[model samples]
Structure formats: C-alpha cells, structure tokens
Target: MNTTKLAGNFLLPISLLIFSLTAFSCSADLEDKVVGNWQGYDFLFQKTEGPDIVVTINGGLEQHLRSKLILSDNGTFQKLVGEYDNGKGTWVVEEDKLITTNENGEKLIYTLLKVTDKELMTLHEVDLKTPDGTLKGKIILSYTR
Candidate 1:
C-alpha cells in the first residue's frame, strides 16, 4: 500500500476507537452524578373514601420513620429510602427512569422530570382500581442536594 493510503487506514480506526472510549467515559461520569445524598421537599396526596389527604414527606415520617438512600455507581443497592414515601428498599435505574422497590418488593415507577446540581424532581402516580374502573393519584416531588 502507498504511504498516504496506509496512513489514512490507520488514522480512521484510531479515531473511531478514541471516539468510542470518550463517549463511554462521559456516560459513566453522568451516572456518578446521580449518586449522592439529596435533600428536598416532598408532598404526597392520597385520595381516600372520605376526603383527599395531603402529607408532607421528609427524611423521617412522623418522627417514627427514618430512611436513607445510597445510590451507587452500579445502580443497585439495599434499602434505599423512597423519595415520596417512608418505605425503604432497593432501587435501580433503567434508561431514563428510576424504579424503587420497598421492603415489600412493590415497584414504584418514577420518571425523571428535571435533574440539576441542586435539584431533582420526579413525577409518580399510584394505580388505583375501583368498581367504576381505574383511578390513579399523581405525586410530584422536588429535592435539593
């Protein structure tokens, strides 16, 4: 092969390898940013037979419930506190969504609304089925780190 042709072939593969490595590194860094101690305000509303009840959810519930969430770099852990509820259990992040399971192993789906250096917001809804059909309660949680 001519000098120019050989150089072009070598450069092409090297450039592609470098690009792939950089992309993977960046993705790993972003995943780390999601892991840490985050504090924020949470409001939970539930629809009951009598009326709608609004409760302010914090780190500890009613001075009786205490929880902690430790999100690791691998997206797996034991008993991470739920942001909306006092339930404690494991959590996992798949794609753009975060799935939290309480001690009972019930899955809670939360979609990432907004995530910044100081704030993280998520929206979730509980599936409720009644004689009339299906009803769901919506919840929004805002947190600051």
Candidate 2:
C-alpha cells in the first residue's frame, strides 16, 4: 500500500472527528448559556401594514402578565408569551435558532439574536388570521434573568 494513501485515509476520519467535537462543544456552550429562568420584559410587535406596538412590562401587575420562559438542562421548556400564548414542551438550539415543540406538536422557531448569562433575545414572525385579512408581523421577545 502507498504510504501517502494510507496516511490520507486516516487523516480524513481524524479531521472529521475533531470537527464534530468542536461543533458539539459550541452547541453545548449555547445550551448552557440559555438554561435558566427568564422573564420577558419587552414585546415588540411590528406589523407589515399597521402600526407597530411595543409593550414593556415594568415591575408591577404588568410583570405578572408578561412572558415567562423557563429553559431546563433536560431539554424541556415552558413558555408563556403574554396572557395567551402558553405551553410546555421540549426545546433545542439549532445554530442560531431556538426551536420548541409544544405538547400539541406545534413547533415555534425563534431566531436568536443574542444570548448571554443575563439576556436572551429572539424574533419570531407570525401570520395572524382574522375576519378582515391575514396580518403579517414579527414579534421580538426580549427576556432577562
């Protein structure tokens, strides 16, 4: 067997293993940063055809109605966005996205803008249907520990 060919074959697997390990480490780092209790304080709703609304929940009764998200190390989460959107389910971080699957098998994907020991910011676009028409907008949920 040619020595160069033998060395090349071994190098490929080793390189791939190193790459996989590095990626897993980075993913675990993100998972660690997000595993905590977070309180939603800023809810920004930007609509495509209407006025954008911003709701800032201060330290009062408003805080009681704001979003609360709990991300666990066991790959589960509970999310309550405002007074309506509430569910408990499993969650995973894929690249820059935080994906959650609720008990009803509904998937909510949030694009993660930032995540730190104290803050997690995410944006999710939604289409709401009403008797008038379909309203398209994006919701930015900002949470703090």
Q: Write the per-residue lDDT of candidate 2 for residues 41-137, one digit (tens) a residue.
A: 7654445543222222122225533768999999999877665656899999887678999999999998776677888777677776555566566
RMSD of each: 17.8, 15.7
Off by over 4 Å in 1: 1-30, 42-50, 54-69, 74-85, 127-135
Q: What ranges in model 2 sit over 4 Å off? A: 1-25, 49-65, 81-85
Candidate 2 residue 111 Cα shift, in angstroms, is 0.7
lDDT of 1 by residue, 1-145 (tens): 2332343345435434533443333424435555765554543333222222222222223322233445555555443344445555666655445687777778887755555566555556656554554545444455666
Q: Whose TM-score is greatest here?
A: 2
TM per candidate comes to 0.50, 0.68
The models' CA-based lDDT, in order, is 0.49, 0.67
Question: Could you give me the TM-score of model 2 versus the true structure?
Answer: 0.68
